[model samples]
Target: MSGTILDRILEKKKDEVRKLKEQFDAGNESKFQKIPFYDSFIHADKMNIIAEVKRASPSKGNINLDVNPAKQAKHYEASGANAISVLTDEPFFKGTLADLKAVRDVVGLPILCKDFIIDPIQIDAAKQAGANVILLIAAALDDEKLKSLYEYAYRQDLEVLLEVHNEEEMERALVLNPSVIGVNNRNLKTFEVDLGVTERLLSRFGKNHDRIFISESGIKTAKDVERVQKAGAKAILVGETLMLADDIQLTMNQLKVRLR
Candidate 1:
């Protein structure tokens, strides 16, 4: 609690990882069939939406604490979401693995376990809880750990969404030759949001046809979607906006702009 927001969150994850290791079992089976997350963007002409099931955040406090994860996920799929991102972190995000399981039980779209994943046990736990994709932030792990986790998730048959914030992290992310890379607009350590983060990074790194580029966070309108899509993002990971929307379907439809 005394450290930076991300520092505190990672510290909490360490404790959670310890608890997960004690309960880890190799016999666990995934309840839902895995959907190819990266493929959804490849075949799409419209900007894909990775709708997030989030209750709260350390920066925003409580966004929608009473949200039903399963119901929200089903709504997303109906509204043309390409994938679902469930925040499985508890200390800061107020989300649990149970929320992910509930969402998985209802939707066939790829499910992304959006958490501060730092260990193999967390990946195993996410897989057991029915995650088709797991997020690996470049800012959180070193090159060695990042490559290890990226390979480990692939071996577990889970897709990795490698997240980067700036030029430095993007450089590190490219070394893994990730299939899906997301540029997070929010700085985890300071908790400041900026849409330019995605544009700047993509402009510098340029775009790739083989890999999917996603702009995550601070997206709220069609124009915002257009901006990132023009920056070479095939997909957008939206959380707070959808969680706080009065009309979830309409909001999602608006965000699903045609690819530029």
Candidate 2:
């Protein structure tokens, strides 16, 4: 079973890497020297919501590829998001470097380039594409690889958000000493979700880790936001729930209210 899991992950990564190269070669990367966004996010007053921009997911398929990246980013900024996350994977996600660059240009908020993020090629691509942050998933990377990638991100002036789903993976991410630690409520193995995952891990983090703890996934309504914030999550990453809202800004404002 473990072998099967490894094989599937490897295949997905191979495809993701191939797609990343295509985005790099597209010639629409950010023209600027990359702004310092980490400091901006660190100063936000409330839960640092990282609004994501993407076309689709492999699980859902085709989620607003036609949505204008800059327009969406403006809405996110107006709605009080601390950061933005752009999906640059073109295969399963149908996203590109243009999407990330678009968000970077239009918004003053810190931006996170969200993808599988397997290799250094993709890391450089992210920097060139104008991402201020990068995600490191513990399930997809070994300890050494995580350390290498996290260090690379930091060297480029990018903050690292290490994501994990379980106690064991949390242990792995803890070793990397990432700037931010995110506990994803969704289980990669079964796609199951429970906010308790964050609550459970809070015990292990203790009170003096200095890591900004974030909770991701299954966050739907203002009530969900309230519950997780009370559970000790400093921030939350919401995707589909906000994406599906009739008014994106209204939805974000509702969540912000709950955070207070």
Candidate 3:
């Protein structure tokens, strides 16, 4: 809260990863199979929604503390979300691996374990938690660490959502030739949201961007969904709006926009 929000989160994440590693070391890793997160996008014609089950965020505070993650995930699947993103960060996001496991048990859709992942241990933790995919933020990792983690996740048969905020980060992310690329409209350090960030970065890829392009953060209305789709985003990772809605499924239906 004092320094940059991202810095604080990363500091906490380092400690969290250490403890998680210890926990995994003590317990046996779950025998899990990777679900197809990217395949759904490839087979789908219209824009896809990767609805997130996030309880809280450092930027937005507590959005919905009492909601059951498993129930919410089933609702998202029924509402036509292509995939589910579960926040596994406990301190700021108010989530845990238990939330991911619960959702995984209920939803047939692919589950993405959304966290500030910095270590290879967390990737193992994600697989153990039933994540078909794991988020890798470009800004948090150096080139070596980024490539190392990306390869490590692939070896475990987990797809990666390489998230980037700016041109430089995008360049680094592209180097890995990631299966999925997320253009985050929100700045992790400052917590500022801008829908145009997705547009500007994705514009460089034009209409034929080969990788699955996902616009993350700051998406609220149907118009917001339409704008990003027009900008060449194949998918949208939405959280806060749906989480605070009067009816989560109804809100998702209203936000659904088709492109093609």
RMSD per prediction, one decimal? 1.2, 2.9, 1.6
Error of 3 at 39 (Å): 1.2
Ranking by TM-score: 1, 3, 2
Error of 2 at 183 (Å): 1.1
The sequence of per-residue lDDT tens digits that candidate 2 reaches over residues 1-260 is 35443346557778768766775664555465555544554455666787888678755678786889899888888988878888876766788877998887888777888777778878788878788788888888888888888888788777788899999998888776565888999886666789889888876673533457788988888788877777767778887776777998788888874333
lDDT of 1 at 212: 90
Q: In model 3, which residue pairs have backbone atoms overlapping below 3 Å?
A: none
Task: For candidate 1, list the clashing residue pairs, or say none.
Answer: none
Runs in model 3 with CA error above 4 Å? none
Evaluate model 3: give its lDDT: 0.88
Cα lDDT tens digits, model 3, 131-209, are 9999999988999999999999999889999999999999888887776899999999899999999999988854555
lDDT of each: 0.91, 0.76, 0.88
* Among all candidates shown, the one with the greatest TM-score: 1
Steric collisions counted per model: 0, 0, 0
